[model samples]
Target: MKKQYKRFRLRTVSAMVAMAFVANAWAVDPFTVRDIRVEGLQRVEPGTIFASLPFRIGEQYNDEKGSAAIRALFGLGLFKDVRLEVNGDVLVVIVEERPTVADVEFAGSREFDKDVLKKALREIGLTEGRPYDQSLADRAEQELKRQYINKSLYGAEIVTTVTPIERNRVNLTFTVTEGEPARIKEIRVVGNKAFSESTLRGLFDLDTGGMLSWYTKSDRYSRAKLTADMEALRSYYLSRGYLEFRIDSTQVAISPNKQDITITVNVTEGERYVVSAVRLDGNYLGKEDEFKSLVTIKPGEAYNADKVAETTKAFNDYFGNFGYAFANVEARPEIDRANNRVAFVLVAEPSRRAYVRRVNIAGNNRTRDEVIRREFRQFEASWYDADKIKRSRDRVDRLGYFKEVNIETSDVPGAPDQVDLTITIVEKPTGSLQLGAGFSSAEKLALSFSVKQENAFGTGNYLGVEVNTSKYNRTIAFSSVNPYFTPDGVSRAVDVYYRTSRPYEDQGGNYQIATAGAGLRFGIPFSELDTVFFGGALERTEIKPGTNIPAAYLAYAERFGYKSVSVPLSIGWGRDDRDSAIAPTSGRYQRVAGEVGVAGDTRYVRSNYQLQQYIPLNKQFTLAFNGELGWGKGLGGQAFPVFKHFYSGGLGSVRGFDQGTLGPKDVTGSTIGGPKKITMNAEVITPFPGAGNDRSLRMFGFIDAGNVYGENEKFRLSELRASVGVGLSWISPIGPLRIAAAHPIRKFPGDRIQRMQFQIGTSF
Candidate 1:
């Protein structure tokens, strides 16, 4: 019965087609009232067109509706042709569909990446698995030609070949003629009043003669590079007080040979403007005084509109901290025509009270979404808090995974009532090696090396090995760190270190120490700019016998010596927004760490602290300062720890002084553990010539001062050893290299202070 039913259905369709054909054979007119029937459809059901058609069965057909129906079908790109036939009291429509593109394949596409070709085609609505028509194919060819032109191939041609295969599908190939990449022969900057032509040309990345120009291909007519040049021009004018600068025109001339290009940029220099007055306008949430203080734009200050706008945003943020989630701030700049100045009026308004819709993170390909979302202080479906936004940016930046972090707020186009927040970031190399070598009088020669992979196997795991060997000391350490413990910024680390050192004067006498431990480190990002980490770990160590050991240390070892164990608890805080990890001038970096023994076979509480700051003086200059302090003590009859102590005055500490030999000593003059010490330095940093702006080849002038003392010895600042010196730092492929030369401002003959000393990769 089922088979018979199916046969009947087929016969019914065939008879309908036959009867319609017979009627059409009687000299049918193109347009007439008749029975309407559709043909030439297989994949697309008949009902789809039947529902879309304006005319019904036996209805009169006009040229307008017939044309409209044909246009609608063609618009779908699924049909090759749609024509109408009219017989007396009958109508028939016939169509032939264009083939669906089952797949897209590329051949000989190394010169132009396959992805680039696919994207070009996709822009013209031609892609894999989509139906294609003649118009679309033609458009694809045009786009291909345009892409080749972008590569400076003026003579390039594109031939599209379509091949029909099985399954009513077709394959497409865009045979390309990739011409040689053109080079820029000359670049001219016109109508420039603020700076010289040479200066303006230097602002453009497209160099007329450069080795890298061939690779970056900026010499080609790149719209992106041209746009960047325009921006550079705008910035150069604004920084010099040009308030309304404009780019009038840009032109590129290709040679007849199609191998050389000449570029011309015309700019309009606007009049420089100055501040006339500063005014504050807008609703202040009963705290105008507080808001006014945060405003950096003063009446007498120069007209820096950017500063005024930033000040306004800061006011809105301040209100956000007070739970005013929808605080709005705007700055109004009023011009003083006679005085040639501008005034800024700051205003704020607290609008509808609302919470956050959802906090979403984007552009983290290697890291999991939960890994980033956990750092958010602002919860999903919670109030939109500016403070939380800033905090989230900071928190994400601190992950050490991103080189830049940017946040944007956008409204859903059709849904004006809804908003979406986007967090975009640029990933950077997290794993690094700290390798160094240098020569110094204090230690004769020195070398320090450390290998660290912060993101092991792209899984956010870290492994490290550190070795510091010199004439006076030798150390080897193996360690591993996980910044994400349970995927929420909870960190963990395991370390094992062994050291053997020869004391100064007793150059042949050696002492050995070893330590092994594992600990957890977690961060609490209380604010966008602040994070604190506190954790503990158990450790075991062995102190081997050696000569040149201080009598105090020897006696202590005899009493409670040889082998011991302990647990150390540590806490640290860090904030780094530096533009560069190795050499930064535009941002700030700060960190503090302290550790104390809590439990084990021995009892001790030891702590150390360090502070560093960087200030960018200019494009090629920076001012930096660093200070370090350490303290150690014994508890429960345990001996004063040797490894826990700090010895200052070296390449990484105070230059011009001997390493480990800077602090005080006993009768034998061995480097006995000092209870406390401090090192302070200030440096003016600059890029080294021949190395460009390489973080590895940095040079600086520095001032250093430090001293160590016994626990009972009075902390005397007046007796601090001060040295002024010049330092150099480099990130060589082998590792980081550092060198410093100093002349002690205050020194006694044979004071063990070296005129030259280096321990690699440290400045000031």
Candidate 2:
């Protein structure tokens, strides 16, 4: 016979006191639980229910324990309903589990990708394989809206749809309707007494829609950009001697349709004060005079906040050079209202000196740890030298393998005199495959292909292959460089190449010069910015006979045979400190190379030198100058090889002249490039009109002068070709592009003028 039983049920708790009262009313006498049973579970495991119960088998159960068991199960958030039933001395647990999310999808989302939306939802705990909840779906919708708003899409709408599927799962889809972005209609500056309103407003990056707004998108409103613009405005005034300048308030307004936005900035331009004096008041390690020399604030000049800040930063960095990592330096100003003058006091505190306890590397998932470690100058357990740390960071950044390299210092927990340096790097793809095609007057049609890996196999080695097919020139080359061939930072490079060239002429010709060579080079680092290279190559040249060939080539081929061989020894030196290799704003670069054919059918000595200097005139303008010189002479009573002569004209040299046409001419009127050359170029570069301050696209006016002289001719300044031109430079997606329109200012009777020139992947 079945045991007699009285059943009691418990549901979710509406109120704690009510649950207890009802539980007590139906409470059963304390009895040892003989068996526990769980029912109505769809997906939840039996063990899960059993573990959540307050009392186990052979334990006493009552109203108090039963209430706790219900609360514990509900806290798991996996159940839609939970119930507890009692039969005699047995406890029955039942649960209806919540449905899990099967998949997440998006529809009509043009502003953002579906994967981005899915990741956003995942961050908020509302993703696939998780229990579905209405509250979490609501939060995900809000998050989607926030992302759209950041892009100036104020009218974006989101609809979340939950479709139930089989096996207690649901699929979620978010449908988005993204409207047009709100544009900045106007920007106004108020309460500006010292400067004109237009001048002050011009300082901000955000502006009314301009002609190039479609490209720049500067007209779009962004709160973060506005905050930065406000800071820039403040800095401008402070740097210009407005010592008490401040931003009073800022107001942003939107149209009723939410299609246009307006921003107004109110500023206070207080009295401009002159600097009365600057005094240093702190311990200087008995080097007060040395520290005093670092001060840049002039006593009689205007009170410029930039100079004050610079002085204080110098003091702090100077202190850090001595291992004081936590140095504090502050510039306090004493204002004299009546005299309209100010005095600055620089206060410094040298904190405890610390040594690097450990040097940790992180975030270089692809590059080897040793690749980054070898570039570091600051070592573990060494004195914390800020200069060395900065140099280490710079060296790693110059490797071009990582998009970002950052170093952070943190104090050790237990040791006061020890710190940890964590170098974090964001690795970027160092390999590139490029395919390009171009059409020109001389080359007609040209195609180029290249494959390069700057950090090959994470080994900090360089590997490259390049192929070019053009009408006048064709080349195929393979190269590899081991940047750290030895432990002492010497670099080794190997190159194998084949090239063919033909003289440019109106009438086509099959006559060509073919060259094949191999070379090995080693670079020795003389300093951080200087490298010396020495190399040797075995080259063979073959002069193919055909029509319209230059007389010089025929003469050389007849005397030295159709084929000639040379073993040339080369030495070079290079120093580059440009801020940017592609779009340099400031710095200088210099290179000198010389080659001597020591043994072979041809014997010659050739040398070339180049210098480039970029001077930044202001924030938006740069003045650049370039100069080059070349000279070559025959050795061992042999004439210089005609194929080794220098050419100067067109895009890279003197614009407005035909390519390789600004040199000596042979009897056939074909331009035979000479053994001596000189070129000079100067440019004033500025931002493109309506492009704001974008450096990637700029316009420049340039003056070019160059000429090539024969081997026996004297160098004459009067014979130098000169041209003036205006050009546009763009760092395009494919490469750097330049287009110039020029007029010859100094030209000879026989000069071949092109008037316009353009090219890609070339720098002057």
Best by TM-score: 2
Candidate maximizing lDDT:
2
Give the backbone clash total of model 2: 0
lDDT of 2 by residue, 421-467 (tens): 99999999999999999765556789999999999999999999999
Q: What are the per-residue Cα lDDT tens digits for candidate 1 across 152-192?
A: 77767677789997776889887776667777788888888
- Which residue pairs does candidate 2 place in steric collision? none
Q: What is the TM-score of candidate 1? A: 0.64
List where candidate 2 sits over 4 angstroms from the true fold: 1-103, 126-130, 166-169, 436-444, 503-506
Give the lDDT of residue 605 in candidate 1.
73
